[model samples]
Target: MAEQGAAERGPDGLSRRRLLAASAAGGAVWLLRGTVGPESARAIGTAPVLPGGLVPYQQVYENWAGEIRTSPLWVCAPDSPQQVADLADWAAANGWRLRAQGQRHGWAPFTVAAGTPADTRVLLVDTTRSLTALSLASGFGGAGGRAVRAQTGASLEDLLAFLADQGLGVAACPAPGDLTVGGALAVGGHGTAVPAAGETPRPGQGFGSLSNQVLSLTAVVHDASAGRYVLRTFDRSEADAAAFLVHLGRAFLTEVVLRAAPDTRLRCLSRVDVPATELFAAPGSPAAGGGRTFADFLASTGRVEAIWFAFTDHPWLKTWQPAPDKPLFAHEVSAPYNYPFSDNLPQPVAELAGQLVSGSEQLAPVFGQLQFLITKIGLTGDVTDLLLAPGLLRSLLSGDTLTHLLAGGLRSDLWGASRHLLQYVRPTTLRVTANGYAIHCRRSDVQWVVSRFASSYQQVLATHQARGEYPMNGAAEIRVTGLDDPVACGVPGAQPPLLSALRPHADHPEWDTAVWLDLLTLPGTPGLHAFYREIEQELLGLFDGTRAGLRVEWSKGWAYTTDAAWADPAVLGRTVPATLRAPGAPGWDEAVATLDGYDPARVFGNPFLDALLR
Candidate 1:
């Protein structure tokens, strides 16, 4: 099942029920029931019966977002496809709106209505518990390829672990471990690397956003003429395939079949306190390795990643090496997942000496505590300590928060304060900064292979130019896999490939590479959007000018403007479909049309999508 979002805490730290009650207190009476049609019943194989009468808001309050802690509603956790169909029928019959909730991980308020719908007037189908089946199937789509079918509720981390256990892995995956497969894919979550050759690139390629890497999907939708039905599609036809691959903005996905890769182990090395400007410089510079260009170093290396702490000169750099085929001792040495940063020394004086260097590491304890608090509130396991800490720092230093300063001139954001202090002590902190995560891997048949190689190389060059500084203090990671789904988003053709092709040979060795990047934004600042836009534009210009095969991950943000580039205008044409687009549906061209006139007051609409449509 998917994890729930963090809600406001009560006196005891648990979410307060009073808040939920308050959110659902005012709503009109609504009765919704489904009388299944013969065809629908046959397809669903028996309609699951639900309890009669209005479900109370208090019953469903636990599923609301933090912003709507006061919402009250009863959630019907459907157990099967049949149950979903029945609920759809009920909602249609009673004129009650139905909103699907998978893991309830989204930070937005779209999942629940503010007033009327929350008070038992609207119905919520909690799919997390309902769709718990995850399995692997072979020969389902030609021989030699494997398919991983996950019910809507599966978590990305769980799915990865499961795939790894089976000697299989996904082509690409998003960063957050707790995000639900359904939720992630719905909003177009993505993974690292660019799309491969012959692949249609999505908006953002580097982050490997959700819209890429979709093989086939099944969804239950309500239609005015046909009632409710299941829709399915595959990546056979170009337009239809691309449309289904991203879903544009259509039906809720109930199940997803992803192409899986063979399993392989990786060895990682990480270094903290690198310079930002030197990290992004071109290869062959003195500050760089001086042997091969920085890009060449990354290409020869298996994988490379960096994360920068805003307002600080030190960055973290991580590189990965494929594990040898021969066996190695399991106890070579490693840090506990709960304390990824425990053993790391303070940012090196060499990296920060001239730059801003803080006077003390006194905030380490509070930082650790805040990390614990964030995990507890988010319901993520303690295992996330390593992965989430950097993100917290990025968010805190990016000036996204309101608290600008603390008592006695301390920066409100701990990471930012540390960065400021570090710079105050070191003059080099004034240099431009670039920080984020990157991963390297052996390449394969996937289309993104070349672009992945190129981006990694480029990042290395950038690091060198900035003077040996990059971020990503954490260990580098590697995983192996055989090619599976060609239609998946991050693969070469789904959208724009993040990485570009290099070379004389189109087909190379069995090994490939995957790189990840995380750009740091200063907290309490407003330049993030501009920074991202500028960098993205520069990258696109370089790639396009050179005819490099690189593509960026669309989920982060993009420079693509054509409606057909990433969006399926058909499915997004209307608020709700006039005809239900079945699972695997390449929805209509109109689906995205209404986005041009989106209303924030309307549920399921956001500024980003609105901007995309415009």
Candidate 2:
């Protein structure tokens, strides 16, 4: 149910079931049925009196994969912070719960749980429609000090663009550009980054998730004296600020002020030639001697990511380095989303994806290979691939003209501002569901983390393939970033986000870096839940906090059973809380208590948050 990526050949990047249903006789009407506009907003029976001067409408909810959909329900768009507060008060008074709705790019039920009926007493506060405001804050220390004050509805892309205009930017951000700033902070969204050898962070810069940059945040909280919810601002120095920093949608944030540093130019290089065996080889092994191992790139440049297609030998590896000026022979980019081949599907890939949607499960191998081939040709613009394959493979790859047509230009190497290179994922890419985790370990053991994950994933895939169950038809994505460090915010008594996955373990001070791993596949693929459950078990045992610790990424899927995600009672009740906070530690319990103290009536919580947070 994640909200990311899209396609044109089918509905939102060819969702398998949707595509099949779309191609069926008289199915187009079925697909178009129930789509309503704001003008058609309706209230169910016995609707309570809404706040004056505010309009309520019926809106359907759908996540990125269209997995968690709902019938038309109540929604509202508040134009200002005070209006949002008014809505919160109205919800509390009228027996309704308020859930902030951003772009709906997330997979988890942080916004609204599945199977929620049309008559439920839940009110969705649509932030993106209004309340988006961005400006620079002044008078921190002197003129050199910089910070951006943005409303919750402001998008990451717009915020980055604003900073870029002033030669100020954040150190890292997630790949997709459409995410709301409030949503990103709520789930502790992060990007791949860490300091290189002998590298020191500049003022106002931190190599952690976006939530770590908060200088202050304004939220709606219950006020005991007022006997209702009221708008309150919490500084990073306050003890209660820790809980609000990454509240996982249990709280509502209206605005945030984030520290920004001077923007740096960057050069990005793409290589689809490295074999997975060498790239993910054992640490210090001879196979990893070619200076192309993942660790080697991380050591030299400190910014890297790998996308390994299923059943493929070579992985598409990308490395980013600080480049003060555009490197000679590097393509200069003017904006974000430069990789057209990735943003849009090529002809062969679209055809294969259509076949997959048509229930041709045996084509998983062909689909994986085809994806890799398209990447190779699209990245380097090398048409020499036509003769490299035989039989059906050659026929499929023979359309070099179509590949180049889909890929606007060769993008093997590029140079630009950090945002252009850092944010490459666009909304037009294929939409898929992903299971995510952050593995905490010492920087020296990053190689071991990658090696173990790669080996275990191969074994799992082989087992499923042998049993004729092609559960995965997508790639394995890997990235690394530094853990959250409160000192980087340059504020005295500032506290780190207590619930953040990157929050440094109190007992394990040596764990400085977090390796982010995600398995991506189209939703509703057969046996995906069981496969994810096995992978989760393997990961929990492999890391086990002895050498490394494992935690779930709040935005993606986790806590899997045989049938679904976020459904395992043991994980939801005990393991997840224990992973975040030890029995005697000052984390999970403190966060839950602080949130409850702010919203004692649980007016801001959903069913999922109610069960998990407790």
325-392 per-residue lDDT for model 2 (tens digits): 87889999989999877776655565565566455767788878877877877778775664566566
Model 1 ranges off by over 4 Å: 1-74, 92-97, 104-123, 141-143, 193-212, 222-225, 231-241, 283-285, 289-294, 324-339, 342-614
Measured on C-alpha atoms, candidate 2 has an lDDT of 0.84
Clashing pairs in 2: 2-64, 2-106, 3-105, 7-13
In angstroms, give how far residue 122 of model 1 lies from its true place. 5.5
Which candidate leads in lDDT? Answer: 2
Which ten residues in a row are the worst by lDDT in model 2? Answer: 24-33
TM-score of each: 0.51, 0.93
Put down candidate 1 lDDT per residue, 1-614, tens digits, no spaces: 12122432331242223222222221010001122232342222222234343232223332222323333354566667666665555655554545666654333334542333333445566667658578885444542345677877887766776666676654345444555787776655543333323333222112234444455566554333553443443442233344333433334567776655554344434444345444544344455454332244354442344443333333344443334342242212211121112111122211221111122122322333332222222222222333455664444422311122111121111111111111111111111122222122344322233234335534543553364332221112222221222333333334221111111112322323433343422111123234344444444344332223232332222332221112224323431132222234323333343222121122222233444333
